[model samples]
Target: MDFETEQATRYQRIIDLLSPPDGTPTSTAKLEGELEGESDDIHEAITDLIAFGELELVNSSQHGRVRLHQPTPSTKAQATLTDPTEYVWHAYITERDGLGRTRARRLFKDREVAEEHLKQIVNVETLTPVPGIKKVWCASLGSKGYTPEYAVLRREPVFQQADDPYPESR
Candidate 1:
């Protein structure tokens, strides 16, 4: 078989091997043994599958498992916020019914006000900090019919240290 065809076949095999019903965690060493190919090719195929979001890798020092990628609703929401430039910092108070459905959403200019309002409505534990809050680049507040739900702006760099030098600035 051609290189592309062979690679495709390998990708399918890996997907099948990692799929549910068995769902057993397969290590890289095991995959190398089972696939009967160059270790590089197998690793590349695994990377490609992960890039395509068809597979997820769970890893530790000793071994790793490849599994079918399962993304939750919250993950989907967070994905939209990956681009920091598109959003602004805003605080929101989301009131949800007993069934966990969102009943009301209110945006606040100040974080403390939003927190206080949220405290009065529901348990603090239920207050989820949404990361992305879109900015209105073009028009004033009056132009928009409804207020956007509040979410905390993720301003910290991924590589920043836990003990931020300027914590007060945040």
Candidate 2:
């Protein structure tokens, strides 16, 4: 996970620990030991949570006693703390030469995004500057354990100079 996600998830954990009747005011030293982080980082997280209105310091002079101020965090805050979903869907846009050999391929996480990219390539909506783009297509891929299977979702002819260009050349 990236730093932001990691930090937010940690913040969520803190909220869960200190929110409600189950939780009581805890010292900063005890929280740092529980979290297993540098004193500075723990202090920073505590300060941030306090500013976010999820936590409050019970003793300003002690600067170590803290408790949850809000039982529930906002939806936006929860969203930042949510774990990223695994991507099972894979889409691709491929470029082929006259010899029916793949010249290039690009992967996308979404099918529609891949199809839109393929459309741009086929229509010359974007300048590729490729000399001979005989065919282009969008393909969906699936994986089962170690094996991968591909199925073409969309195909379009591009600069087709010949119906069969050097058919036996390969």
Stretches > 4 Å off in candidate 2: 1-3, 37-40, 71-170
How would you encode candidate 2's per-residue C-alpha lDDT over 1-170 as one tens digit per residue?
01344546566667655644233678877777777853346666665455333455676454467776533223333333234232222223222111111222445656567556555544322322111111222232223553222222322112212222222223
Residue pairs in steric clash, candidate 1?
Answer: none
Give per-residue CA lDDT, model 1, range 1-170, as digits (tens). 02355666777777666654233456766776787754458866665454333455666456556665532112223343445233222233321111111232455545456555545554343333211111211011111555422222111212212332222224
lDDT of 2 at 8: 61
Error of 2 at 79 (Å): 27
